[model samples]
Target: MSSSSLEYKLIKENNSTQGISIEGWKIVTKKLPILNSQEIEKVQKEILVPLPEMFFGNNSLSVSNDDYGVLFEFSPIDALKLVDSTKEGGEKVKVAYSEEWTLKSSKNHEHIKDVIKPYDWTYSTLYSGTLKIASKGQKFEKTTERIDIEKLKIPEPILFYDEIMLFEDELADNGTAVLSAKVRVMESGFFILQRFFLRVDDVLFKMNETRVYHEFGTKSLLKEYSSREEHYFKIKAQIPVYKGDDISQLTNPDWVSSKLTNSEELILENLNLLGGNYSKI
Candidate 1:
């Protein structure tokens, strides 16, 4: 498909500044899946209503009979399996199996205590923003400014559909599964900066021994501004029909890395270089 056909708008707002941009890019597919119409509809419905709703109101009183909507959503179970190809002519690539799965939220409130107690000294500062998709040929416009995180409350736990699948019949007959969904990006290429900030800090400690920090810090700050990284996250895929092709038979999939070479990094570098402007908490 022509790169011009794929356009996206990205709006990022932090403690510093908010910026929006438009851009064009191509989504080159590798091992694309053949999803049935029903599967596609299921995914769209799940994503659109990531959370369920509950209603609360009085049946009698006219003055205090106010209705309230509450969200109650559960995380879906999904698993992705990578099986080594046994075919003769094909390269040694693994096949992906996606499946519908379930995740049981911990019934034990003590489990939450066990998890959060360790981080008692550490507090969580969540940063969340909306990314809206624009229809093709639609002009870009900024609709909402700042969303108050506190006021924009979720009454129930947040849930996500699983991206991985496993099972035998899922991969039977040369079926392919989706590796990743198309991500909408900013037009001006500033979205990469947003992604970098969101992902890098969370995993910086993992790359510490590799000298990633020193190397990254010393490198021309501006040069790293518009960089993009391809993260290979496993999701639930379909299971092949074969008895031996179950989810447990698969191994970890290799990671894919790509940089947003087309996006500009000058703005990102300036923000990083200018100290004390962007605070963590």
Candidate 2:
């Protein structure tokens, strides 16, 4: 028997006063094919139970918390269903699977623990890997680290990107995709706009449509003068590349350059640096 490869994508959605919203970005999964020899070995392993049964059971799933919030949960079955629904004709197949958990704050909440929401999420096929068998069972190793978020002191307006390229195969040569940017605000006040870029492979096609999150810092301050606040902002855009487009055209360019240039021009034209820090992240 031989194995085949598959890909999967994970998405999570939530509802807010502004209506339904989506948090986080996409994640890719690489699946190894199932082979006859592997199937037989799986049966044998089931009989012997060589693996640790404790971690293999429902206990395999759990949640944690930080100053942010409790970890939400995701289900493999739910991801499969989402993929099936979006497929061209709803092709049915046995897909490689996994579970995910995310901890998010409520719309009106400040900290994760205060207004925490737990979600059991799932993703569809993203990517698959090759399967191999070994005569002697392979050894396994694991490591764990724990840290207190409140104990660590970090700056406000923490900027983070989802790192899209790690799951390149999930993207098509001329297909469109969305990248999310999350800005977490701490200590409500004035923060200047800083430089940011998509940081995608040059080979990635140009984005067709782009949407940005409203500058909440300015808006929130106008609404209230409260301190010790946080905001999660997201921006989603559609990549613009058609099937069979030259891959070379998409490769190697400063993705954030144009955006930075535009910001500078906007500031110069307005004569007021209303936003905070123009430094690139």
Candidate 3:
């Protein structure tokens, strides 16, 4: 593995945190059970939108470079904050059963009202990751650089991999909404994806994905954000007739992703890991 620049060892602690430490980079992941009532209360106060039904408040995954003093983290709370809280934009998607859920929530979840506010019920967010720079002069800047999918396609041994679900909601049995993160470390570098999947039974299916890719020993990393969506009937028609009987495919992110169109895409940033000292490629 050293030949591929991935001389790393597996890291495990307390059965809940695990990852890999390689050369100059360290990747860590944490997964915990659903938040308790008390923990949910605290999060509700901190975030503007209504908390999802199955909030894993303590779940997170992060990548850090000690030499570069760069840390990027993904968590449920921080991602939800990027939702359309104002609702004035008129782009928010409303679940087909919003009215029914609203009525039931008003009667059964009295405490939720204290923090509930108008927001995108779908919980779509463009958050790539939370980046913290402990080193001076290092920062992310606008760039036209993009991730080379062709490079990623090359066969390579995966050194480490993990996926965690941060949160999910049933939308009062009308549909499904979920947020999750997954990461894989290969010989050259690594890739991370934070995805939001939404399916409104008869309304639509949408997916928002934030992808980050970095090559080992490189001075920069590329972050790409993409949004894909399709109307309920449109995507439904694309499902293979032989497998249409498996309704679960409708909620599968990968399936929905392949059927939808790329509505928008952006190279959010090109992070310079060498304190703004890298030569332009």
Candidate 4:
């Protein structure tokens, strides 16, 4: 629990409202109802294959069969901490966790130009590309919109697993921008909360939003997080944080928000676990 050059501040209620900002911060929320790796892989390979098609909706985007072998792999470089809260519910779940996860993609793509051109960048925390914004008709030469990652009190922080599962998502979602963007574009950091096994007093529930970059990209595309406001977004599902006790519960309050209804069924089917059903499939 000793962090080098880490500063601590008690964020009060007044500070909670009006966008919580972090300098050089990345917020990772991991939803693990079926914490089994093989089940997760099955969801990624079988269930998610059709998502990009659903996400892009008619834009021509695909990988050559040969590209598949080279394009996907897992890495341990990604770190994890319990997200104090998240956008999983119609509102933030004060009781359970929200983990931050990203879809790992190899820079090599199907975009063949006789000679392939690779953008000399690996990861993006938030979509902070200045040139891409200009293409969208912005006034400034460069202005990065600071995303709001909630402020929380992390007791102890640690890496989630020895190795994080990395894979390519067929669909690339630019937040709410997914509703548009007809052409097939691979989404970075687009994720869903399938389900969770909750304990309000869970050891992993407390976490701090690490001071990190808006995203990882080309040297030019990497912009420092500025406090100025550019564009504002008001989501329909705006849930606030709450206070809670150290208690166990049978049902996750945010079960309705889960994309996977068969989490318990998958667990029982794969692992033959039949007793506990916090949010049983």
Candidate 5:
């Protein structure tokens, strides 16, 4: 209608990536469409990620450690089995993706990498979601160490991928008990670093670990991820922030903390994980 108004509209369109910003960052979320055969093939070649299974299963039990005030419950619906590298057609690997989880994108978003790797050359897929718990769940003691990599026998992961899982059942005896962030295997499954921040009840802790897949036991270093990973959970939520260009129904970190509640004292407690719990020498 007016000369100045029309000019502004054109400028906005040209700088499309400028997008809508929240906290000085663009946060755009777009709904995805179903994939045809060709599209599915493209996805497979890009990141032959294994089909992710439900996080919590029907047999979820509840347990707690009275001594440590810690708890454990919630059984995973289906364990994410290793990737099937054998391809008869040489086109696709064996993995199962439910129709619902098959398609979604977070393009033009800062919180999560949106683009598929190798094929896209732009972004990465970092998923975030919640694990629903029932009120009628059983309760017991966390008699054993919840995470004992040594206890369980693990087959060397043929797939090149990593996972970072964190849990904080409750703090101050009142908070959302949650298990968040277990990533599915991507096609470019090269070995790398993995870390997790775990909190059972009032206890807050951190874990830094790695599993290197030395190709053929002596593969050149050039073909792998960093042997040592220098990383902390960069995002405050450590879970998905279901605010912008994504739709996996993840927890939002609109506030300073998204651990269900924002408390200054609890934040200090987590410092223990970083050796902040120590006193000056």
Candidate 6:
């Protein structure tokens, strides 16, 4: 599983795209500027949803194992599409300032040129990476398995790493919403994390995370998706006494995630990379 034994290749493009191919596995990341007006309009039309204030429509990250013929991709378009539109009542997120923003935009009546539309301003998404399988009879199955966090903490040297931001919005200045993905490769294997964080100043804080792990020379991979949320004041109370009013810790995703007591299990599954290698783990 060491780098010396693998055919590892790194491809870098002028447009800020990078790719790593090793041992029949490929990981690619693209970081581009925010979409122009025309690109935003096109995406809005196709997605039929309000684009975020700062939308990076061209950003994306993808990982695939040629041995299994499976590709997992993360993109702004696909991630935002999963956000609940105004029509979808289930798990709809509306912050305290949602009403204030809408009312202020309508105050001018007919004279106003544009009015703010009502949707999940927080941009909460349960996106756990899109999966595509090209090989027949190979698929992901539910399992009680979990990533070996203890193993990952064993201090192995990281061979490759990259982080990419998919999209973000200020939530009308009420708070912030951001979605990002990162990956790290090690001699034992690799790990991928896609996280979405939302914070509403006085209302709530939320996080949705997807973790994928693949051991070197293995024929399968494991993925776990989980969500955690808590009211704003409750998490704020967890801040250290000396750090009061600073609120810097609240902006940290890792800190806020650890304080979120309300937890939910969204998805737990494992995929067999090679055909007929379905022995349960």
lDDT of each: 0.19, 0.21, 0.78, 0.19, 0.23, 0.78
lDDT of 5 at 37: 59
The digit string of per-residue lDDT tens for model 1 on 1-281 reads 12433343333333322222222222111121234456545543533211111101010000000011111111121211111112321221111111110111133333322222211111111111111222221221322222222332334211111121111121111222211221212211211111111121111100000000001122111212122222122212222457344443222222112212233222211112222322321
lDDT of 4 by residue, 1-281 (tens): 12423332212233211111122221222211222455444444433112222221111111111211111111111111111112332123212222211111122223211111121011111211112112122221233432223321223342111111222221122111111100111111111111111111111111111112222121111112211111111111222224244122212223212312222211100111121222232
Q: Model 2, 1-281: lDDT tens per residue?
A: 11212121222222210111112111121122222455445543433212111111111111111211222222222212322233322221111110100222122124323211121111112211111211122211121221223422445533221211111111212122222112222232211211111122221122211111223222111111101100111111222346344443223223322322222111011111122233221
lDDT of 3 by residue, 1-281 (tens): 34555468888987889999986789999999999999988999989888888998899999998777778889888888887777542224434445544554566566433323466666667777788654545667878888888998899988889999888988666578899999999988999988899886666787888889899878887888888777776888887789847777787788888788756665567887766554331
Model 4 residue 172 distance off true place after TM-score fit, in angstroms: 29
Q: Tell me the TM-score of model 5.
A: 0.18
Clashes of 1: 38
Q: Per model, how many backbone clashes are there?
A: 38, 33, 0, 21, 15, 0
Tens digit of per-residue lDDT, candidate 5, span 66-151: 22222222222221112222342112210111221122112223322221222211111111111132122322212221223242
Query: What would the per-residue lDDT of candidate 6 be over residues 40-143, giving only the tens digit for each residue?
Result: 88899877568888888898888887656778888889999888777442224433335533454466445322223455657888888887654546667898
**What lDDT would candidate 1 get against the real structure?**
0.19
The parts of candidate 4 lying over 4 Å away from their true place are: 1-3, 8-22, 29-31, 35-163, 166-281
lDDT of 2 at 65: 18
- Cα shift from native, residue 161, model 3 (Å): 0.4
In model 4, where is the ten-residue run with the lowest total lDDT? 177-186
Q: Find the 10 residues in a row with the least total lDDT in model 3.
A: 88-97
